[model samples]
Target chain A: MALIEVEKEGKDMAGTQEKQPVRVRGFPFYPHFLLREVVVMCIVIGSILMLSSLFPAGLLKPADPFDTPSPIFPEWYYLYVFGFLKFWTFDVGPIPAKIIGVTLPMVVWYGLLIMVPFIDRNPSTELKDRKFAVGMGIVVLLGILYFTYYSIVNH
Target chain B: MNLPDMIYKWFDDRFKISELLPPIVKHPAPEKVTSNPLYCLGGTAFLCFLILAGSGIFLAFYYKPTPEEAYKSVEHIMTAVPMGSLIRSIHHWTANLMIAAVSLHMIRVYFMGAYKNPRELNWVVGVLLFLVATTFGFSGYLLPWDQLAFWATKIGTGIAGSIPVMGPYISLILLGGTDITADTMTRFYAIHVLILPAAIIVLLGVHFMMVRIQGISGRL
Candidate 1:
C-alpha cells in the first residue's frame, strides 16, 4: 500500500511536462522476477541431472515381431486410458465396450477438458464461489489417478 | 566509451532501444506470482523444454531413423560416442520432467481459475501445447526401435486405431501402413524432430503473448 502511494505521489510530482509510466503494483520485473526464475531453473536442472545419473534411461533388446513382452504398457501418462479400457467390461446398448472405452478417455475426456472454460460460465475465481467446478475437477483428477493405478496393478 | 558501450550505442541508434525497453523493463511481475511457488510450474516446464531441445539435438547427431540401423545407432551412442549415454539420459529425464511440470501447471491453472474470461484462448493453447508435448514423447519413444519401443508403439497405435470413425485413418496416417515397419520409424522420427517442434514453438509464442496481454489471474 505504501509503495503504491509513493508511485502515485511520484506521478503527481511529474505534473504535465514529463508524465511517469503507470507502474503496476509489485517488484520490478528485471532483477527481482527474473532472478527468481533463474533460481528455479537451476534447481530444476540440478534435479534432472541427479535423476539421470542415478537411473539412466533403459534399453531393451532389438525389436522382434514374434516375441511379445508380457504386460506391455504405454507411457505412464497414457496409463489411465489403458486402465479405463481394462476396467470397463460392459457394453452400452449398440456400442461395443471397446469403442466406448477408447472414446470415453480419448475423445470425451479431452473434449470436456478443452471445453472447461466455456462449460464453467461462473466468473468467480475464489474457491468458495466455485464449489461445483472445483468438485468436478477433483472428481476428474481422482478418476485419472485411480485408473493409472489400476492399469499398473491389475496388469 | 568502452567497446561494449560503443556496440550498444550503435544498435541503439538504429533500433531505438530506449523506447523498446520500457514496456517490458518497466512492467513489474505481480507480487502474488513472485511469492508463490505454484506460479513456478509453467516456467519450470519451459526450462525443461529448453534442456530437452539441447539434449535432443545432441542425441540426434548419432541417431538413425531406419529400422535396421536405429537400434544399433542408439546402442553405438550409448556405448561408443563420447558422453552419449549422459546426453541421452539427460534428454530422457528432461522429457519426463517436462510432461510432469506441464500437467502440474495445468492443474494450477485450473484450480486458480486462471483459464476463465480473457485467458480462455490461452488456456486452449496451453492444452494444445500439452498435447504436443505428449505427442513428442510418443514419437520419440518409437525412435530407438528397441523391443520396448516397438511393442509400446504397437499398443499405442492399436489404441488409436480403436477410436470410432477417425480411428483407422489416424492409425494409417501415424503408422503409414497397416503395420509398424521401416516407414513407421521414419514417420515417427519426422514427427518428433520436425512437426512437433514447429507446433510447440508457435503455440508457446501465442501462450506467452496472451499472458502478457491479459496479465496473471492474481490481478483479477
Candidate 2:
C-alpha cells in the first residue's frame, strides 16, 4: 500500500508540471505580420517610389535604339563581368585569369558543390565535422566580396 | 444558442486549432537547431526579392516600355521624380546583390551537404531558379533602352540565332523579327514585367514551403 501511494504521488506531480501554463511575458515584440520581410520589402519599395516622384516630368527625349552613349556599360550588376575582362588581358597565363576570374571560380564553386554529398561522409552534428565546409564557404564569400567591392570602387 | 452566437462560437472553435492536435506529435523527429549566424543569408535573399517585387510594381506605374519612350521615361524618373535616381540605383544594386546572395546560399548548402539525400530535388529547383533569375537580369538590362542595353541585347539575341538546328527559329521567337527592333523590346518587356515574375512567385512558394517542411537542412 505504501509503495502504491508513493507511485501515485509521483504521477500526480508529473501531471501538474506537464499541465503548467507558460507565461510569455517580457519577450521582445514580434509583429503579427512577418516583421523582417515586411520591413525589408518596405525599404526597397519605398525607395523606388520615392525615386519615381522625382523624375524629370518634361525632360523625356525620344528613344533611339541606334544612338549609343559614351562609355556604354551594362547595368551595375554586370560590372563584375566588365571588371573580369580587365583580369583576362593575357593570352596564356597561369590559371588563365579570365577562366580563374570567371569560369574557374565557377567551376571550383560548382564542382565542390556537386561533390558535397560524397565528401561529407560523416553524419555527425559536431562543428568539427563541418569545419572544412565552413572554411570553404568563408573563402568563397570573401572572394565574392572582393569582386563586388572591386567592381564598385574601380568602376 | 442563438444563430449569431452559434456562428461566433464556430469561428472561435475553428481558430483555436492548436487545441485539436496532440501536444507532443512528432514524425521526422526534431533535429538539433543550428546556431549558425550565417543562416540568415537565405532570409535576407528572400527579403530582397520581396523588396524587388514591390519596387518593380511602383516603377511599372510610371515606366513606359517602348523604344520610342523607354529612355525618356527612365530619364524622367531620374530627374523629375524625387529620389528617383537613388531608387533606381537601389533596385539595380539589389537585383545584382540578390543573385550573389542566392548563389552564395546555394554554395553554402552544397558545401554543407544539405543538398544530399532527401534534398536533391530542392537543389534541382534551385538550379531552375538560378536560370530564371539570369533571364530576369537579361530582360531587365534592356528596359533602360541605353547604348549598352542595345548592343548587349544585339549580341545576346545573335547568340540565340547561333544555336544550330533551331538557331534561326529561337532567334526569331526571341527577337519577334530578324533585327533588334521595337518588337524585341516589347517581347522582352512582357517577359521582364510579367512572365518571369509569375514564375518566380510560384517557385519561391515551393522553395520556401519545402524549406519549412524540411526545416533548414543543417547537421544532417
Candidate 3:
C-alpha cells in the first residue's frame, strides 16, 4: 500500500493525474425526451385540422330564431344533466336534483377526501397508498355513471 | 509454483471482481409499479379536451356566427355536411366530459388535501379555470341561435343583471344591447372564441405548471 501511494503521488507530481469531480444535472426545461406527450398533442391538433377541412362551409338550413329544432338538446355530455333538468317539474317527487346532483355527491366525495391522509396506515410513497383516495375517487366516478344512466333512461 | 504463488493465484481467482475494481455498496431494489393514477386521470382528461377541440374546430368551419346565418349554419352542418351531426355530437359530448373530468379532478385534489401550503395558489387557479369553463359553456350555449338560445340568454343575462351596480351594464354588454340579436351572437362568438378560450389556455398552463412543480400529493 505504501509503494502504491508513493507511485500515485509521483504520477500526480508529474501532472499525469485525473480527478473525477462531482456534478449535478438539472431537470430538462425542454424534455424532448417526452416525445410521446408531444406527439399525442400534435396528432390531436392535426386531426382537428383534418376534420375542419373535410367539413364544407354551407351544410345546414339558415338560422331561424322562432324555430325549435326537434329533440332540443345541448351537446351529448350535457344531455344527461339537461335531461335531469327536465325532471325539474317533478321537484316535490321522490328525488330532488339538488340533493341527487349537487349536495349528496359533493358530501360523499368531500367526506372521503377528508378521510384520506388520516385513513392510510402505511403510506409508502407519493404514488402508492392511495387506497382511500381511490375509494373516494370511485364515488365521483359512480356519480357520473349514475347521472349518465338517469339522463338516458329519462330521455 | 511456490506456496505464495499458489495462494496469490487462488485469492486472485476467488475475488476476480475486486481485482478489477472495488465492490460497491448494494443498493435497494426498486419496487415494480403497476400504474400511476395521476397520469391516467390527467391523460384521460387531456384526451377528452383533444376530442372537444377537434370537433369544435370542425364545427367552427361551417358555423356562421351571425344571427342570420348561425341557426341556418347549424342546420346545414346537421343535415348537409358529412358526419356533421356526429361531429357536433362528439364536440358537445366531449366538452361536457371535460367539465365533468375537471370537476372530479378538483374534488379529488381537494379531498386528498393536495391543495395545502404550496398548493393553495394552484387551488385558487383551479377555481379560476372552473369559472372560465363555466363562461365557455354559457357563451357556447347562446351560439345555436334558436328559441332555446334566445330564452336561455335572456335568463342568463338577467342573472348577470342581478349583480347590482354594474350588473345591468354587464348584461347589456353580454347581449350587445337590450336584446339577443345579431349583435348578441357576435358578442357570444367573441367571448366563446376569443375571451374565454384565451383565459382557459393561459390558466391551464399555469395550473399544469403548478401541478408539475408540486408533484402528486402524498398518499393518504
Candidate 4:
C-alpha cells in the first residue's frame, strides 16, 4: 500500500512537470540568431557574384551525337557514380557486373543512406558514444573521395 | 512611431502582424546551435537555394528549351543578352555551392546523430532533398545542350538505363524515347524549370516546418 502511494506521487510529479511551461533556454531568433544568418548570406552572395564575374559559366561547342566527347564527365556531384561504374568490372552470382554497379551505388547505397537514422538505434548524440556510425561515415566519405579521384584519373 | 514603424503598424492593423511574427521572430534558437559554425551549413545551403532561384528565374527568361534553339539561346545569353552571362554564372556557381553545402550539412548531421528518434523522418526528407538537388544538377546542365552536356547525359542516362527492373522505364521517361532528342530536350527543360522547382519548394517547406516544430536536434 505504501509503495502504491509512492508510485502515484511520482506519476503526479511527472504529470505536473509535463504540464508546466517549457522554458526554452536560448536567445531570440530575431537580431541574435538572424543577424548571423544575414552575415553568412551576404558572404555567400558576395562570393557567388565574384565567382560569376571572374570565371563565368562555360558553354562548349554544339553537341554532335555522332562524335561523343572524349573524357566525358557528369556534374561533379555525380562523379562518384560515374567513378563507381568504372571501378566495378566484375559480376556476382546471377546479376551482371554492370547491373550490380548501377544498382549498388544508385539503388542499394541510397536505400542504406535513407535507412541510416532507423538503422543506428543508438540513442546517444555524442561522438564517442557512436563509434560504429562515425566509422562507417568516414569509410563512406573516403570511398567517395577515392572513387571521385579514380573517375578523374582514369578518365 | 517612425516611418518603418508606421508601415509595420499599417500591416499590423490590417493583418495582426504582431501576433503572426512572434512565433517565428521571437522563437528561441538553441545557444549551442548559434555558437557552432557547423550549424551555419544548413542556412548556407538555404541561402544558396535562394540565390539559385533568383538567378534561375532571370536565366529562364532568356533560355530556350528546344534542340535547335537551346544551344543558340544559351550562346546568346552568354554573349549578347545584357547581364545574361553574369546571371547565368551566378546561377551556375550558386548551384554548385548549394550542393556542396547540402552535402556538408548532411555529413555534419550524420556525425552529430541529430537524426535519431523523433528526427528520423526529417533525415529521410533531407536525403530525398539531396537526391532532388543532384537531379536538379543533372537535368540542369543538360539544358545548355553543349557537347559535354550531351555526352555526359548520354553516359548518365545510359547508366540509369542499365538498372535492373525499373531501369528501362526510368531512362525512357527521362530521355523521352530511345535517345536524347527534341522530346528529351523539351522534357528536360520542363523538368528543370517546372517539376524540380515545385518539388524543391514543397520539400523545403516540410523540412523547415519540421525543424521549427522539432527545433534543432543539435546537442546542447
Give a tens-digit lDDT track for model 2, residues B163-192: 445668978988999888889889999999
Docking class of 4: acceptable
- C-alpha lDDT of all candidate models, in order: 0.88, 0.63, 0.59, 0.88
TM-score of chain A of each: 0.87, 0.44, 0.46, 0.85
Per-residue accuracy of model 1 over A3-76 as CA lDDT, tens digit each = 57545543543452246654445655666678889999889989998998899998998999999988787789
Question: Sorted on DockQ, highest at the top, how do the candidates line up?
Answer: 1, 4, 2, 3
Worst 10 residues of 4 chain B by lDDT: B22-31
Q: Which one is best on DockQ?
A: 1
Q: Which runs in model 4 stand beyond 4 Å of their true positions?
A: A1-21, B1-10
Residue-level lDDT tens digits of model 3 in B57-169: 89989999987778888988888999897788666655665676677777666555566655667777776776677677778878877666666566556545544356678
Ranking the candidates on lDDT from highest down gives: 1, 4, 2, 3
Q: Which run of 10 residues does model 4 chain A get worst, by summed lDDT?
A: A2-11
Give fnat for candidate 1: 0.77
The CAPRI category of model 3 is incorrect
User: On a 0 to 100 scale, what is the lDDT of residue B99 in model 1?
Assistant: 94
Docking class of 2: incorrect
Selected candidate, larger DockQ, 3 vs 4: 4
Question: In angstroms, how far off is A8's CA in candidate 4?
Answer: 36
- Residue A41 in candidate 4 has what lDDT? 84
C-alpha RMSD over true interface residues, model 1? 1.8
Which tens-of-lDDT digit does each residue in A8-109 have in candidate 4? 444443454467754555656776689888888888889999998999999999999999778898889989888898899998888788898899889999
